[model samples]
Target: MSSTISDPASDGVVRAADGTPLKQRLNRALRREKLRSFLLILPLLAFIVLSFIMPIADMLFRSVENQIVEETIPLTVVALKEWDPASGEAPGEEVFAAFHADFVQAFKDKKHTRLGLRLNYDEPGMSGLFRKTGRPSTKMQPPYKEAFIKVDEDWGTVETWAVIKQASPAYTDGYFLNAVDAHRTAKGIEMVPENERIYLFLFGRTMFLSIVITMSCLLLGYPIAFLLASLPLRSSNMLMILVLLPFWTSLLVRTSAWKVLLQQQGVVNDFLVWIGLVNDADRLIMINNQFGTIVAMTHILLPFMILPLFSVMKTISPNYVRAAKSLGANDWTAFWKVYFPQSIPGIGAGAILVFILSIGYYITPELVGGTSGIFISNRIAYHISTSLNWGLAAALGTILLALVMLLFYVYDKIVGIDNVKLG
Candidate 1:
């Protein structure tokens, strides 16, 4: 029997007396491992860029993008460049000729309506004026300022010229300004009329609701998490199922259930009536209001709080509390000093998660939230799909995203992100 002895370095790896080849091989191995790790994570990295980063970048870009007037009325854009706003008079004949030339072609190309709508953002009645003037623009001759005035005397005003000049820029801060309940005027940026300002109120309401929902979740989830963590494994597993059962249900289904339960004529009202807490004739207005949104959202997000708290609390040793008590501390004092502080990591994680989720929620608030409970997300959706005001929608979305990021920054500063415990 012929036996072959295997050599450790038989694969032709070279080695120097100083072990330089060994170090080179180790470096190569480390590089190979790093490459493998990068390859493994590449797909996830690409997915995040495409799905999250790209959309946010696009939305932020669109918020400041204003090319409608410049693109649709090229001649007018050029003409307005030299026409000074300080002149305090209507545009001159040369400016009118350039505008009339562009306006006629825009009318012929069926772009007048779009240009009109774009300009109308700066001045509300401009759309009607443009729409009415489209047909008559074809009939106008030279000295077009007089012709334009004949079509609509408002076009003769310096304010109309100012609006056109303001909108002619390819990029603008108007959308962002408008989003915060402010507008650009001849003087400078100023607040919108008090009656017309709703965005600030909407933002306030969204933050208020988000805070209330987060607090509600904390109050309800903390005790349950403590119970789950303190119980035996078998009992904890059973109780955990009860907490997680909501996760298995469809979100829409759960929200609809809340709708049914909270409706004026629904089970909750009937129960109140049966208990003589409320009369049948005076059912509570719970659904389609802020109360319904808060109740439904709190129920939906409670699990998020519970899971984090339970994870942290389960790892906490009972001996800490016992030791505190043996040292002359009461039950409440032991818990407050030893237990609750440890659980704060979980609280920070859960509160931030619930607050972030609640602030951006749409469907739950939409179905239950009548006019009063609607969030800024609802308005963003409205501008995106209904009004076709994409720039305005993007601005609103950017503002909300900024608010979330600001909250995250504040949380990080206060709680320290590294201290937040997920498990």
Candidate 2:
């Protein structure tokens, strides 16, 4: 027999050629793989942080920032610290003198417009009030309280000073309060007058419309998804082309097409006239209303609902339904009892996606939603562009972001995030 030799590597302690342990060599291999994977994803990670994360962080910071008053009226802010509006005492002569100097400087620097705009959010009409008073500020002399009151008797009241005092801080929740349709008063936070409380209504309408659109998409998409999943391969592929055709078209183009199709004198009304459905003189009011929003959004988002349901339904074995039917179960009973529960993951995924997208929609609503049907996102855009009230816009955006995150949290808890499938 040939001499048998024991290999040191096989006995118990394996080693690399240079005598390094095999365990260390394997760990080094794993480390290389981890580094390579991280390197491959670094660019995408950086992009997400810079584009999505940073902007949202900046908006959250801007929501609570309140520097307009402190910057414009530095001396007035300092002088008002000792004064108490709740004490029912007017600020003394020194406070008036300091305010006079600060207001004059602000006027000369052309910062009065910004100051007025900021204050007007807290106390309406302050913009015009400041613009009117700023022009005559130079004519006022010492014993300035009387002279300032002459510019506007409202200046002598404690209520006016209370607004100024509340706004003195460099950072505050005043914008958030305004976003919720409340005001900071001497007593504390209180709701604005009934006529002025519109933000809460807009928020409620946005959520309501979003739910309606999601439900509409579900109702229309379920049967189509089932048909697509159940049909023969060639037919399913052809139908899928139609379902995905909208993605090839521009969103603006689709919205504009709807506007043309739904207008009073457009194809829909003209067809109704031709069919003698009703008199041609009184065409239905469809576009630029809630009906238009619901219809357009349902069409645009229907594919999202269908794709998820189709992905889930395609994986479901037909044998389950066949087995149930062989056991004397009706088609409806088999589907409701056996098929629907398994398909719920798709429903949750699609509903959350559609609802979230609908809440933040601006261009669609702006294009077709008239004043009555406009969303809260439209209001955010108005404040951002037309009103130039970035603080309020940021506050509104932050609130909306919070709401979306809360929905995701709830969905994750109820359905388990792992169950969400988006093929």
Candidate 3:
């Protein structure tokens, strides 16, 4: 006789003595599987939190922070409680007295003076004010009001007091406003001067360049993606490897190569002149300009656009286009009205990826485009490293982040990000 095994589902082999259903045993197994899956995901969750989330949070904090105000004029901030921001006039003499005291103390402490100078470097005329206040001689006198009055005489003026009253708070929105081409005055909002304006221009240029490059990539990449998608699997894979070959090269090397290719004495210029395309080599404005940047960036970023499009195009059935053609639609109409619309997800994803990356790029623009073509990120880096102005750098970074977020939000609203299906 064959040995008979009890069926867990039918015979309830794991049932409790109280006669509970074998369903409980199945539930226990299911829960164990779920727990094991969660355990497997735990490390990834920790990695995301530690590596990405925490650093972003720290950066955001640094962007809007006002530590200088807190440390420099603690007493003034406390004393100016009665001063109303809405009233928009100078605070009482008591606020000035507190400032005087703080300045005197901070002046005596060389370290604190240096800290104040560093913090205020971004603000126009602040370096001078800090230097004046941070002097050792400025500390020797009790209540340095006389010295302060001598420097500007506005020290006693309502406007001077108003400026201090406005700036006295331990926290501020000043840096943020300045970063976005907006300025906060006693009256209202206004545009910054052209000479003083940097971020706004860079931001606009960055956006414009990114859009142009993305469009160029889309126009060029779409045909290539379609060709690859139509090919056999083996042929398509080979083509894909060729398309992705640029990724193996270093970014700097590629950019430098473009520089060499586009220069006045380079092959491109020689060909143009030889082919009688232009009367002179000087006619080709290829290097150290927007054209150079666009060419190099589009070349570097083309793979990003192509891969998504290729993946999307591959999934789309060729029969749909044929079906549309059979219904008497022209080939171009069938493609535009049927096939192209289906490729929207890939287009959106690739455009967004390239745009965001392009805006933050510094090296290519700095190297090939020169001072005239520098982006906001270049200025931010300069402020941090050369000027040693962390506050300005943070403020610039915050503005860039906000703009990128705004762009993402607008894109999401127009076409839901969730709708994107990447193979």
Candidate 4:
């Protein structure tokens, strides 16, 4: 038990009972502890990567991915590279011959329709041209230019080949350009026609409405939160159940209930008629517009605002307001200067949560928000499910994500994220 090794390393150092240097043993133990900690968190890390990171990565990749045109007509793309779009005429006979090969092969494989769709996004009539030419393209002779013109006049135009050359790249910024309501043409990047400009307006509307919803929640929830914080324990607990009652119900059910209440002949209109606020025949139109979306969403998101404000207010001591009043400050001055300032962290936290939720909310906006009120998210959903344009959907989603991140960064810089308190 008293044996000691005469090792150089352990001359003046403490040793373990097994005669190993204590410092070496401690370093080994520390490494083991670190590895154990990493092992414990490995499952959560893997879950985050698989569920969140991978999908986002795939979306970013798809945003700029445009391989369908190139993959469908490789020889045509190569042939058209040297053809000048400004020639004010169709590509040469040789170029048409190159495309003739790709056209026949793609038709045989039944991929010409897909290629047509990809090109149709840039030039509208290409889909019909490709589909109409599908079968006849097989019987075309060596003089493809004359045969193509005979089949369809579009094949004899420069606009047709220009779109093909533009979309020939394996990867492109076309989707992102389209996301901002612009397009890449043979000339250069330019905004779409005024009638086609939608994405930018929707983006602005989404941000504006989200802010309005956040402000509405704050204004309505603040007083309630203050009352909750000031009330006696049993009464506050009972009041809190009322606040939390909406959470117990399904979101769809709650939105549907709002629909029944806000419709033209619904309970709200009936009540207004009874109160003589307006004529019975002149019922308000509120159910399927911006107003309805704001009302329904504010009600749904109010709890998010109230809970944080209440939690923070509950931590603020009553004695601070009392001390201010004792120092000759009026009741309003004391409450405003001391108590309200103290509760700002909660306001910040609640605003962030509600705004973020409102911006991304699709179901509520889709249900209550008719044509004029739907958010950009609704358009993204339509692209993904209905249009099946994953590229455009991914670009829109990436932009939305970037917008949220930029706002978060600005908020952090202005308000200091560390100052926000949930409790």
Candidate 5:
């Protein structure tokens, strides 16, 4: 009779049965497991690449892309290729003639001048140039040797052509420079004037605000988290629900409620006055400032800090502190040296979360701080919605994103983000 035999490589038994070699069968099983794991993770990998990586790449492209210039003045750009800026003489009239034709065509097209104006607005006074180029007088004139010059006398000046020439490139760092309160010149880079230098100041203020808010949340949330973690299960569950109650409310509602409560004529001020704590209600300045922003944001983000800390503290047994005390370490020393070090992961996680969220906060700062209280994001919003400067807006956004990423990198280096466990 034929006996069954195992196919060692395939982990399959033959009709002439015999056992497979252990190593080969184990390798086959491992290969199957690896294949199954890959299949299970394939969808997630595809989702991350398509949704996260691709969109970020596109945003980075937009941040540096200068399509308006490339599309608007193709002819002028071609004509000026041989023209040298250092020559100190005007480019040939052919350059002007090409620009004149382009301008006339753009005016006729109605929307074309807008592209030039938008591109030029980054450099200032380009809008006026577009307006002059679109004038009826320039449009009605017949072609002549000086017809281009007649369109705008300034067009002949080397300075005007130089601006146009410099802007002809497909990509530019102009927006990025401007966002950082700096700009490029013919000579090279230079600092912007103090009066107009808003971004650097705003960036500093945002960082300061984020740091303060993060610290405050840590100080206030740590005790509460400790209490929740140390308590029995039933009590901890009820307290956690209370702590998380803010999460159920909309952020906007919470901020608005603070505004009503903290206003000079609001409940808090009235209570203080009723309790004889303050001399005047007007002294209770709450809305339209940094204090309001910090208070509202701290309240909203406190739960984030608390939850992670509670999880970490819960996993840490009280016996460690007791064991330290038994070994002659004082209560404060034991808690500080033993417990605090272990909770670093939670601290890092909470701080990173709060700092990142604080940097991007718009509505709270806008509503509470008003003009003086606005952060970098408010300026970004204005540039996008009102000024219609996508380049500047994108540049500002890119800078904010970079700062947050840098913070993450630093935190990861210091505390090893890979080791951070939420539970």
Candidate 6:
């Protein structure tokens, strides 16, 4: 009577009615569930990998993938490896012979000119030197050094040979270095001359303008969002339409409209003059400057900020504020202590959205931002389209990506990304 009943599974060998261990059965079921979940999301995963990850990875690789020179003149690279650039003279007959062996066909195939153009990014005369030496370099005999030197004295200079050797590697950090306004030379890495140091300035301007735009959106959007959330269902739904109206129109059209409005003689300045706030003779220089870029971008991105804020604010209970007020808190004190903290998640979400979008935006900035306001992205576009310097463009893009990621990390650290929510 006093004996305790033996517990089922006391031996830790629980089994199903079919005599299978329950743990094993549970694990098998979990495996099937995991497989099913993975299959459901497989399409989305593939789309992200193909559309976003692959393209970004390719761009990142292109930042360091500088194989054209190595591929075009393999023999010259090998010959020059043993030659010392410190000697203040060009390589001897062996190096000249190796270069000539490859130069004729490369020039004929137009590969040499492309290589020259690439090398010329670092060494100014390389493109012209390669072009001038093309057909004539083919006729030069065993004493290739003397013949090449007579054709172009630049060919005999240590600086010229040094540049080629520097560019001979299949992969390089030169593009990235140049992106930060530095260059690779016989002196190792050095900052470019002050006048040529424009990329850093553009980076600074891009970051500064992007911050200004984000702050502008936040300030302008918070009130609209609070108003929308505070309204009744019917009124809020009607007001929401106006907030979304911008999405129906073309972005280019909006930017162009801003251009028309912000131009010196455009509607904005014309109205200001009419109101006598500004003199007609001294119209504000709005278009093609930082002010134009900021105003246009802030207007364009404000809706993005408002939507997030509204969604989160709508979820917040007005009861909390009422309770604080009932507990003897003043209107301002209750809002500052209770309502603002709860709305911070919305602020975080909207700030991240507007900031990231504003940082990468080139179209709006390009149209409104002139020489002074143009961002690093504009320079990236220039290198890609006009200069065909894809390496530099890729490097600049990679740097921008890193910068955005850094800002995200900082925000996460400061505000806690876990606290950021749209609703």
Model 2 clashing residue pairs (backbone): none
Model 3 Cα shift for residue 93 (angstroms): 6.3
Q: How far is candidate 6 from the true structure (C-alpha RMSD, Å)?
A: 3.3
Model 1 scores a TM of: 0.91
Q: Write the per-residue lDDT of candidate 3 for residues 186-233, one digit (tens) a residue.
A: 677677877878777888888788888889999999899999999999
Candidate 6 C-alpha lDDT tens digits along 45-103 = 99999999999999999999989987898899999999999888779999999999889
TM-score to true structure, per model: 0.91, 0.93, 0.82, 0.92, 0.86, 0.90
Q: Residues 202-244, candidate 2: write the lDDT tens digits.
A: 9999999999999999999889989998899899999998988
Judging by TM-score, tell me the better candidate of 2 and 3. 2
Clashing pairs in 5: 3-16, 3-17, 4-15, 4-16, 4-17, 4-18, 5-16, 5-17, 5-18
Worst 10 residues of 2 by lDDT: 1-10
Cα lDDT, model 5, residue 132: 66
Residues 89-142, candidate 5: write the lDDT tens digits.
Answer: 778867766766776667776855576566565567667767766765345444
Cα RMSD for predicted model 4: 3.2
| Stretches of model 5 off by over 4 angstroms after superposition | 1-53, 137-152, 280-283, 409-423
Q: What does the lDDT come to for candidate 5?
A: 0.80
Model 6 misses residue 133 by how many Å? 1.2
lDDT of each: 0.89, 0.89, 0.75, 0.90, 0.80, 0.89
Model 2 TM-score relative to the real fold? 0.93
> Is candidate 4 or 6 superior in lDDT?
4
| Candidates arranged by TM-score, highest first | 2, 4, 1, 6, 5, 3
